[model samples]
Target: MTHQTTPTMLDTDVLIVGAGPVGMALALDLRYRGIRFSILDASDGTVVHPKVGTVGPRSMELFRRWGVAGRIRDAGWPGDHPLDIAWVTAVGGHEIHRLPFGTTDTRPPLPYTPEPEQVCPQHWLSPLLAREVGVHPEGPLRRECRVDGFRQDPDGVTAWATDLRTRERMTVRARYLVACDGASSSLRKAAGIPAPSRHATRVFRNILFRAPQLRRQLGARGALVHFLTQPPALRFPLRSMDGRELYRLTVAASGHAGNRDLDEDALAMVRAAIAFDTPLQIVSENVWYLTHRVARRFRSGRVLLAGDAAHTLSPSGGFGMNTGICDAADLGWKLAADLAGWAGPGLLDSYDTERRPVAERSLEEANVNLMRTMARELPKEILLNSEDGARARAELAKELERGGVRGEFEAPDVHFGFRYASDLVVGDGDSDSDSDGDGDGDWRTDAVPGGRAPHAWLDEGTSTLDLFGQGFRLLSFTDEPAAPPTALAALTTAFADRRVPLGTTRCHDASVAALYGKPHVLVRPDGHVAWRGTQLPADPGRLADTVRGAR
Candidate 1:
């Protein structure tokens, strides 16, 4: 007689390792595309000491697509809080320079995007996304589930994980696996991907505390961030985390160049940064190493890396998490296409080709911000009340202005100006789509191939961006008494024959047509322009195949 044992098994179209914001963003996108996937995380989905403070505008737009942007906007941050960035000697001390960004309620409407950036810390954001991804027992997200290892074969990937609470063994099989396991990703190591450091690592400390009465005491003088210019000890940012009582103060862990003060007192630093005595409680202290690392490759066999796993940059400009979210958006639709059996041989490969460059560029930009902050000179005289102190403060302010410190806070191009260049994207004449920023100030209107499609208002409350989400979209611009070109019929038939999901929209607005700079535009599911021209190609099937990564 032989005894047989049963195996606990799970199967999905895609298996996601890690449930941080980046991983959850991917889940949101996959859910939007009606795909089956599972997210595994070791933690219980609680963010105690949040690292990310503000979501960038591009990430907010993607969150809008995922149907949670409104929820994030309503997640307890006050609407009337000042959105300014101030360089001060300390809180309630001498104001060196101030970049005034009006409050959310008073800021002028931006013409480029419908959704602006929002201040949603990870603690508030994680729970909202977890609920959206479904946290039930039968749901796609499995918290307290740690994946130990995985193996890939010709058919799919098989992962072994253990429920941390029960210590029970389980197996997960999927066609593809994505590792959003963060900067110290073990799966990335297991896959033999090398993420070499691009800059020397430095350790910094964050002190999270609740100063209940601090906001009331400051009154109209409050700002979103107070960049401390204190000499030798406190030269980092003391930020308002929740626009409420919670705040975080960052400092160099080593004090000075050779101080070696690893056991520095946390409360002492906090008090030194605050000029007035107030009721406060220390919540937690975190010491994190800042490293600049980008993986040599984002994919290895069937396993892919995203978020901090693919690239880890300084948080000086808040680009780390936002870049990872964009990575998820780019990969989400491609994975769906592959699962639906419509992906070309080169479609999945374009994820690496398109996103790796963006990561490198963002890493460089973030590092520049970091170096600027690190190189700032905080003379001891800047803290005095004498005329020399005032002179020092004025000189530093002038230097900051000359260095363009405001770009770190007010860079819309950093958020929305990256263009993808790959085999899947069809470029027009002399179109160098690899540029990272808006060179000619036309990023908001130019529908350049391999870039995000331009946004225009179709009506009072609707934007042209609202037209494309679930699949490919074809926009036809026709003036009055002029019908859509005859070539549209051929394009629609060609896409239909290949079973590709394509939506067609005909617009008669001359202004919108002029903004697009073309009579016909094809937008990908991720909202990037695939191709735009005055007339469709004679071989519509070839155009469809080219955009689908088949040609």
Candidate 2:
């Protein structure tokens, strides 16, 4: 007596769950690779309480590849605002230490990167990415749609969702399913991948407010972040969210609570941090848990995890979102390779092997930063203006100097220092060689296998990094060119036979050659070095096959 109907099927090469910055980043990468993918999110694409404050330099480089770096740089943050990090007894009170990072417009160019970090808070970043991903009816983005459940087989994944607005049920059939959902990913739990916490989970509160005249009042005393040293509750950061009037103050949640205790007054906390009266309007207050977690596995069968779904770390060093963004970049090309059929079985598997370690390393670094703040002993005497207070301030300053607080704000190494070691990367096998030195060497100068290719200025406006992203790029130094006519022919034919995209560029720059530490360097799509040598391999076909994941 019942009528049966076939479910509506929406097919795509990839289905992305969650529309956060990491998911949007994956969408951008897939779009650039000419891959068909759809994004799903339950809520409308609006970032109400922006959690991310800064996009790291490496992430900015990836954004540059996606054609949105320029827009992110110009996202409305004032160019003249101080980027300094100041430690103070209170906002308008005695300053303990100041680490001066010049404003965006006046900062000297970094020798290691073409793009530096940008402060585009999630509120401004979300709409920009959503527009770039296309929010039209016929587009790949599906907002206000919640996926109730999904099932995956060897062939593909079938996910069914109901449009929250229209109540229309639909099914998405995709070759791969990526969970970019937050720290608490339902998909990850469904897949039985446990992201066990590595450290004790702590709760914190973020109060976002608008202080229209505060910037004008403070003037030159203003800084990007004001680390308050007030005893008991106010030993946290009050950061300028948008360089102008917007700001966010972080405070510890009340005793023995984890994001559930709402007893702390937000206004009082804000007032306690700022030592002066100003026109203030509270925007929103949020309670979030800081957990250091890394999933047991980054991939399970056809289901892959990226971003916070795979790991979650403290926001101390601003590495949480940046780490996830890098995950998207690493997973994007591997997914593309698998979908395109050029990927060997291990190529996709290498994603788990490579990215999981980086997440773990970042977790440790972030925990160090978090622990440093938690371990600090802030005395009430630091707040006084008397001689005793000055001594206390000086002693605290000395402790701050010894504690290395600058690492929290200015660790380019944390942003760009990671090296990827996997089966896909071909090591040169010379442990004693300068290029193959142990991991303690400076990352900026090493072109070691499984490391990011060093950046060198190709032109006034272009970097060596600009040559990567789309496919494998082989850079041959003219001083000791890796490929002769025959070698070039063999290499071209080898990669062409497998239909792997490869681009070759011959460079005559001695400086670049020295920076790379090799005459020939093979860089991956994600801008990590796959292999480097003084000359081409004996079997170009084998080299191609190895890097392409055939072996």
Candidate 3:
């Protein structure tokens, strides 16, 4: 577990800490932009628990940009395992509500995005990305390295790190330091940024184990995620990780009372969730506190926070890692712009203004999902006797009907519906109107203002998401100007001349044109629309400066 260590001074445009999905993702973006950067992680390059089970549609779209989406799709998750979200009294117990989203093969083609979410968990995903990024001896990825401290200058940052194996200290000087570290980020705390909780915190434990016969034992009852509802012991998900022997069971830590050793008792808790008797081997156990929190700020001098470092939310809606991936993408381009010297002055600061609100919204939505589960009152009759078992079943069904349990599992809105309300976004003066022309000021569900440009199928094999992978894309209709106004083209050329990695494309499709609500739409490198206008702006230099953060 040790590697040869030679004294060295490493220099790069950016130094990224934490090699989780978000850190690796930021590395991928920086690589594509041709930005010189290094990534460091404390652990030797291996993933455990894989807390993240599914890649959200938006995150998958970004992966497609990185040229790894196809590999992720081909990852070993069973093609036929049910992708549906099912709620029940137990794994084999009474089924209450089911959102039957078809498996990867059975689902109909989506018009908007080619990369409809896949079931690849983190353990499978992390290695594939690491391989593509190339962890050579002097490559940007430095495994088994831990960042201990960093100091920032007006122009750059000097970071000190330790080799976990050799215990040798080293220094890295870079223009910027990005902390993609997890929620309990030592770096964020070291930088003196406080992440105050927005709501009460709750603790839970995840148990990863192998159950070879569990899937077959359950037979037709096998599901991607099974929520256990029994009280006092298990009340969380028993999910199938990759449909093999691997599985994850989440249980409330509070149920353990004060017991420190989690052995047979923990196994028995998992056993109670399923109706079938199958052999199981416990792999690893992790106890984590779920908090709804957003850091007071995301940036400090030359050091910036991304991913779990910036915000942490309940996993009820599965937005934890996806939010971080989006953060990497947003910060990737802005950092590249700044490094390349074409970025506007305020570009980096906008990262906080635009992303903080989205994190707040995600926190609120996830808390709502958690409340739905926490508020359920287990009926006394259900726990009472065999004599009133039939009456208990009736009461359970009634409660399920009123409980709206499906929100816990099927939250497409949280995954894809967030919009940015930043100073850079240009509105058509109708940003508050709904689809029906009602000015309700309800922006969450409404697709106006800064919402993600809708998805549409452009061809038999391609989707609108496919068009935006490599760089900044400008999707315009044929009726609009054949080329962007001269000013816009000048800005594009300026960034391109400096090797900033931006691209512009025009889409003549009638459907995409309508979805974007403007003739010319400028999408950022991360696929979020940065600027949109009914007609090309008169001064392309000003627009470019605005988009590139020059203004």
Query: For residues 1-551, could you state the per-residue lDDT of candidate 3 as single tens digits?
Result: 99877756788899999889999999999998889998888888777778888998788888887889889999898887887766556676665455677778888965445677888898998888888787848467888998988888888999899888888888999999999888999989989999998998877888898988877777676688877667744556788888878988887765343555334476776677766677978888887778777999999988899999999999887888888898888898888878877677888998998788778888887888788777776654553446585577567667766776665665556666666666656565663532221134332222354566556777776666666645667766656465646655775676576455566667777766667676777776666666766776676556566666666
After superposing all C-alphas onto the true structure, candidate 3 shows an RMSD in angstroms of 3.9
What TM-score does candidate 3 get on C-alpha atoms? 0.90
Cα lDDT of model 2 by residue, 165-273, tens digit: 8788889999999999889999999989999999998878889999999999998899999999986668889999998899999888764543344566678778888
- Model 1 TM-score (2 dp): 0.96
Model 1 worst lDDT run, 10 consecutive residues: 430-439
Which pairs of residues have clashing backbones in candidate 3?
111-456, 111-457, 112-455, 112-456, 344-549, 344-550, 487-540, 488-540
Displacement of residue 111 (Cα, Å) in model 3 is: 3.2
lDDT of each: 0.88, 0.88, 0.76
Off by over 4 Å in 2: 1-7, 255-261, 432-438, 480-482
lDDT of 1 by residue, 254-367 (tens): 543335565677788898898889887999988888989999999988899999999999998999999999999999999999889888888888999999999999999999
Error of 2 at 222 (Å): 0.3
- Candidates in order, TM-scores: namely 0.96, 0.96, 0.90
User: Candidate 1 at 127: error in angstroms?
Assistant: 0.7
Which run of 10 residues does model 3 get worst, by summed lDDT? 434-443
